[model samples]
Target: MKKRINNHQRSTIKKVMNYIRRYWGYLGMSIVLAAVTVALTLYLPVLTGRAVDLILEKGVVDFAGILAILKKMAVIILLTAAAQWIMNACNNKITYNIIRDIRKEAFEKIERLPLKYIDGHSCGEIVSRVIADVDQFADGLLMGFTQFFTGIVTILGTLIFMLTISVKITVAVVVITPVSLLVASFIAKKTFSMFKLQSETRGEQTAFIEEMIGNQKVVQAFSHEDEALEKFDEINGRLQKCSLRAIFFSSITNPATRFVNSLVYAVVGVVGAFTAIAGGISVGQLSALLSYANQYTKPFNEISGVVTELQNALACAARVFELMEEPSEVPDAPDAVNLEEADGHVALEHVSFSYVPEQKLIEDFNLSVKPGQRVAIVGPTGCGKTTLINLLMRFYDTNSGTIRVSGVPVNDMTRKSLRNNYGMVLQETWLRSGTIRDNIVMGKPDATDEEVIAAAKASHAHSFIKRLPHGYDTVMAEDGGNLSQGQKQLLCITRVMLCLPPMLILDEATSSIDTRTEIKIQEAFAKMMKGRTSFIVAHRLSTIQEADIILVMKDGHIIEQGRHEELLAKKGFYANLYESQFVNTSSQA
Candidate 1:
């Protein structure tokens, strides 16, 4: 399992590198500049030591020589500073551009993903990957690269300079350097799993928060506030534990590496003092060697600190890659053609489907509807009513057999073209944060202002809309939070009315509205369905009483099919359902 995880991490790293490859030229330039900066910095100690020697020679200060060396050193320092600034600018540009591309790709992947994938994952978790995780990845990369390139050059250049002065001191420095790296590596290994768990828990906590807040009304209605709080506490506690564990492990890396670095510096100083006394190296060379020793060990401390951040970034990247790797919706068929003018004739033959293969939701379903027919489906909540709509709309293809629209198999037509022929108004109304006019015109983007008002009037939404502060131009809050539920439904209905596609689907579209408003909307629907094939899925028997055909379903099969009055006369499942609702309504009255 550990090997498999390592392999997966390696794959994710390679994917990120591909994005980095796009800005290779800029990255290369940054590295070159960083190297030059480090080289200039390394030369400064040599000049300082030489100046010290010049001032000490024969106990007489050579002021003129020292001044010349100081001027040259100042020039080097200025150039180093300039190069460092330009290098940082390049690093920032590269980091931000790569993150921008990553965000763009992640969002586009969400668009192409199958509905099943979206339904199976929490919305908050998905959002966390696209926003929070990606943001963390970008920040880590920025720090990691900034330290990594310069630290490497400093370590290598310092070691080479030290070797030229005295191999004995250089050998001692090398022996102690491994201790710092080993300490960093061990702590990093221990913290990797902790950070991974923390990231996962954080996503779960975010998802719970999103779910709870979005359904606040339901919680209040059912008096579930205490339960919600308890659940939130449980998730929050888990996240705290994971975070503490990760932070504890990561906090040890820097101090431990720094301790090892200090040991190397002290040993080099002591050994170089002895070598200088023996005349094996000059005072100037001894001073330069001491400075080089610090430079050599300092990168290890910086690198150790960065290891913790990079580990956290890796965990976040793994999650983002996992989402991107999920299979997208099956591609359109190579020879698929556009559905230009559908005739509103639909047929299903030997069709079967299931959300999970082990649990069949629809099996051997067969149906045929002619143009201009209205078919109403009535069933228990779990008895394949909405599943049939999913199949017709190709949200999920049938597991076996085929569905045809106007004598052409659905699979043979492009999904966009196939869906364009149908307009749907679902029980759960949806409105984005936009003007009332924007919401109404979504069904037909190029719709005229006059046409939008006509649809709103037909759906009984005009009066309330006119009362808003800006009428049609009023901006809505997220999900139309400012509007009442019934009013939101009216807006949704108006959207469909504006489009008036060849095929119409009403999935309990009026469930949230009052009885009077429902009647008005039904009258409008009656007019709209005049020359279109309509499918109505409803639990209220009164709504489908006038349907041309009513199909009663149970256990994934159609148990009865006939006109509503005819089914009532037969006293079967449909009759029982109609009688129960009627009795409930009469009692309430």
Candidate 2:
């Protein structure tokens, strides 16, 4: 029984309590307003009945007294309304702030999360957690508790007033409330699971849409639009079914509540007529009792509706809190320390790692680079070259080895402190839609015009940039579509150079450029690498000639390591790779 209760009180109630505890002042105000509103509403009919009784008995009602009573009742209602509105407005403001906080925190948490966590969850799934689930919960939080309390308080106050007026009529009306409540509860319980199922299905559909939009280029390239559409339709069909089920169950509440309310209304009319005939109740009393009975029944119906809605809201809240309670992707260790000085001497010692548990991608990987040494790493496809760079950058923690900078383990360093110390140029250059200067100065926002120009010149990108329609201020189109592949790469290189970090990693940075641009970029690269501890993941052998050391990787291990000239003479893996390249070049010639 305890376990069952705990299950019912999971994420939703926990999350609701957190919000309620934080904004209890606003909630308290709203509740007080609600009580006043109900009290005023309950007394209005009694005052109206008194006015009627006075008029009938005296043949002339006390005008001042009746006006005073009406005026007092109106004042109560207006004050109650104004207070409730103010409290609800305050509640809305708090809810907006809470939603913003949740979304912002969720995004920040997602950023710190390990690559495995991101890769395991689809973009749609994570988006659903952040967007849809949070939205539903936030909506529920804003109105669910306030409206529910109002309904309950109103129902109870109405019942008390009815019982005071006459026991028989009160009994008749009260009997229907529980029967309505039980039926509504049964329907709500039955429908709660369906709401959850519908939400999950919607999330799946959302994820698919996100995936498709993010990879629209791939979809068009593969001509899989029809297949994608078919799959989407299939998921949408399932979503429709879940939606229908939820709606079907929810529909039962309103009609059932109304049916029970109609029965109470009939009973009240019959009992009230007999009471008036026997002198047990006045005509005014009977009319007042009838009005109160209607008022009471209205709340019962509203309460029933609110109960079902609360169940659905709870389901959404549960999903949202479940995500919030998930374990952090890369939580800080107990002994973590902030990095102070970043001299950029990156070292990897016995660094074994793998994305998949079954396959060890880097078994006992060991490497050391002196400060300001330019090293090149070359390998066949899937040979852990990118993995090694990823490990060096501390994007993924090594499975069994230690990666350090200046004798300090990277795991101990704060991510912000560590990442801010280095610059990178990736193979696929991503340029946000912004001016050329905007993209260039992104690396160092405080950079002056002269500094931006100097960095661009050092990257060999200044000449082409100057020729654009708007020169340095030319707006780059979406994804840098306005620029050539080589131009985009040059722009990215310029951005990296602007940072002027002591450490740099160029991962297949020049591979997309033409031979002419590659030569030009190599010159700029040579200039940038001087006195910087740089790691170059190169495909072309010509690029590695000037490196102080070359590491040839195969599978997941380093098979050859030496200076460029020294490796050519060994007739090993590096020698074979060089000879194979030579043969391919000769055959092309």
Candidate 3:
């Protein structure tokens, strides 16, 4: 089992450290340059002491020498400042590259994931994992590594200079350092836990918002406004509480560091007073030591602040890693073979399947469709019509059966190559926030304008599309909100037709359309399915009557399988279903 460091601070720190290793050259150079800059800064205050002591005691100050010393120091300061800038730029460049790579990999992984994985996670959560989590790593790198490296280097250099000036004062400063660190470490540990809670709460809040917004129509239809608001408020309240606690712990760091430094300063002041009175230390050296002490403690305080932030960042990194480590649903098997041009044949032999364990939906199912044959599945709700299609597409593997396409087991074929042989129009149409042209071309990215228009015409969508404000260029909002449900479904049909795959799967394709649109759509569909192996899941029996083979399904079994006339003559399930519709029509009349 992998140990999960859920704390943002800890996860951020670890990721930053990992990045240092990833870009070791940049990290090493940055550290070295920063150390030199800090060493120069500490050197200046000591130089000031020497110049002051000489001017006070000599009675005859060398004016030319003083001018030369000042000029040399100025040049050194400028050079060191430039070096520090270069080091920081390098760190930023490396960090940006690393973040870009992470984002790309996460997105690529998502593309290859199985449909079950998509079904299990919300769109918002998946988006957050890729976008927000990678951003956390970038921010963490800046806070945990670059700033931290410079602060530590400067603090160490300042301490060394102080020790050379006066061992007693250096020891006094060092004594307070451990106590400050201990306090900071304790606070950081607590902050880490709080940050983890904060991140989890945020994820929940995002999930809630996405769910409510995505089902806004359903919520309104069911009059669930109060219920939705109450649920959102609960998540928001939890997020606020966790965020406050994390921030509170972070806030204590600076004060705690400053308080310890203040005590150290008081002790140093008493020691300086006694030393100056006894003539054991000069005013110039005392002044320089005081300045160096401030330099040393300043970075120490900064380190404490950085540690707090690092803890939070680490917590975020841990969450991101969890996403990265999720077992991929479409992991490729070794030596997987690519599927070439398929012959449009499909077979499911003794197949058994379940969406989740212990909830078996299909058992010992057998299906075979020859080249260019059309099969229609008619069933009541939850009779596994969609599940059959899922198995054919290899979205979920059969537990105890072999599914083959063109005589090759689906599992043996590369996922991309296998999917290329088939085109699908889902029960629920999904449209991107783009023009009608864009959505149509999604099925075939390289499709020409004429090709897209032809596909739309074939799906009976062109006439309606032409009436839009800008026709093919008319942009749609999220999920094509500007279009009616039937229009959306027709657009999906256009998309699939554009692909021109050898096999087609239509899951409740005409369910959303009105009678007039359905007639037009059915005409288009009939033309589209000509000489193609196709599976249609239909609620309306009339649509399947002309199918080459009709399978009436119930409880994951084919209760009736035959041509329209054959099944009607038997006076079984199909006949009873046909009679029930007639009885409803008579009652309504």
In terms of TM-score, the best-performing candidate is 1
Q: Is candidate 1 or candidate 2 better by lDDT?
A: 1
Which whole-number lDDT from 0 to 100 does residue 194 have in model 3?
A: 84
lDDT for residue 493 in candidate 3, whole number 0-100: 90
Query: lDDT tens string, model 3, 364-411?
Result: 999899998889998788999988988888788888889989998888
Off by over 4 Å in 1: 57-59, 587-589
Which pairs of residues clash in candidate 1, taking residues 3 or more apart in a chain or in different chains? none
Question: After superposing candidate 2, which stretches have Cα over 4 Å from the reference?
Answer: 1-9, 51-77, 329-344, 431-438, 463-488, 575-582, 585-589
Q: Could you list the CA RMSD of all candidates, in the order they appear?
A: 1.5, 3.3, 2.8
Better of 1 and 3 by TM-score: 1
Better of 2 and 3 by TM-score: 3
TM-score of model 2 relative to the true fold?
A: 0.89
The clash count for each model shown is 0, 1, 16
Ranking of predictions according to TM-score: 1, 3, 2
Q: What is the lDDT of residue 271 in candidate 1?
A: 98
Would you give me the overall lDDT of model 2? 0.82
Best by lDDT: 1
The global Cα lDDT (0 to 1) of model 1 is 0.91
Q: Give the alpha carbon lDDT tens digit for every residue of 1-589 in model 1.
A: 7777678667878998998999999999999998999999999988988887886757699999999999999899999999999999999999999889988989999999999999899999999998888888888899888998999999999988888889999989988787888889888877777878898998998899999999999999999999999999999999999999999999988889878888988998899999999999889888898889888888888888788988888888888888888899998999998999799999999999999999988899999999999999998989999989999999998899899999999999999988889989999999999999999998689999999999999999999999999999999999999999999999999999998899999999999999998998999999999989999999888888888989899989999999987998999988889878997779989
